[model samples]
Target: MGYVMQPSRPIDWIRNAIRYTRHSPKRLDVFKKCVKAEKIDSKALLCLDIPTRWNSTYKMLDRAQKIEKAFNAFDLAHPNYRNNLRDGVPKVTDWSYARKLRNLLELFKHKTNNASATKYVTVNMFYIEMMDIYTHIRNMKGIDPESRLMADAMQNKFDKYWGTNNKGLNYILYFAAILDPQSKLGVLSFGFACVFKAEKKERDQRGT
Candidate 1:
């Protein structure tokens, strides 16, 4: 739910494809044939994403990506599937974006689980997990235009809550990291430099 997902046609197609196949038994049988036609041996099948559930979206997209070929095959075999969907069938590029989006969200799902765990002292892990997500967004930005758009949107939301200028942050995460001894000030300073973009300047004429 933290993700600031831009409304997208690719996701809409994914949603519609799952609904198209799963809603009707006839469609499901035909989709199974198409799945077999594609030699997709996985037991998992496409399911719908719930808007409010973060993991559900990941499950939906991840499963859809694994069986994408069957969806493509279904598009070709069933003529009504196209006419029924307002967005029509997804093109090759649409699937490509969907793949990228799934990859992007995959990490978030894992980290979300880690943060939500109740049996451990999670505070010490906060700075590292948040920073990893920050790094991932930076890495994802240069993949392509569509990726940049997605990354940029997410970055904005990230900045809103966790940016250098934001005051709502819990400072205890820094203390927890410091108290760990393995991290201490070095990890804290590194995080500050990265988040604040405040690189160390050389004392002499040359830069550090």
Candidate 2:
């Protein structure tokens, strides 16, 4: 949303924190002491993120958050943790935003990974993947301000191709879905119900 940072405070502060801690052996040692004092147990230490990939950022935050107490401690123990950053130190709310974004990104990373898998791509998978995303977006619309904005942006892009208002429905996707035992007519019916209400379809199915 706001560059790679989502809301700017979440990812940007996170990026700075990791780079700050690991930039020098001395600084990292101080952070480790903070970690130890807090009794933090982690298999992985704080890691930097690449600006291009959300998953990398997610990993960075996922690791950082496990030792959130350490980070808070480091902020106090190391003066530069505040003085070095242009944006000041990470706060409770910053971590809260990070926590929410981290949770959201985890599911998205999983979806993108599944969709991006090249080992075996199938026609039926197309609809299922898209449907999952569409449903996810719809559900996320009212959850939080950031999520609503993100979901709305995504929904806009999604609608251009797959919206019911679009005249050219891709029947091949339907055919593929119908053939898949895991996702057959029910998925299509659900898709139709999303565009057009389920009540009508339910009545039609019942022939009543």
User: TM per model?
Assistant: 0.82, 0.75
Question: Per-residue alpha-carbon lDDT of model 1 for 1-208, expressed as tens digits?
Answer: 2664567888887787789889889999999999999999778977887765557788888888888899888888988888888565877888888877787788989989999999997888887888888888878877888778877777778888777667988887778988886778988787778766521231132444
RMSD of 1: 4.8
For residues 1-208, could you state the per-residue lDDT of candidate 2 as single tens digits? 2124345656687778888899999999999999999998886978887755667878888898888899889988998788888565777888888888788668667777786788986677877777776777777767978788876666666677777667787788779888999888987787767756633563597798
Which candidate number maximizes lDDT? Answer: 1
User: Judged by lDDT against the true structure, how good is candidate 2?
Assistant: 0.76
Highest-scoring model, TM-score: 1
Give per-residue lDDT, candidate 1, residue 181.
68
- On the 0 to 100 scale, the lDDT of residue 40 in model 1 is 92
Off by over 4 Å in 1: 51-54, 198-208
Candidate 1, pairs of clashing residues: none
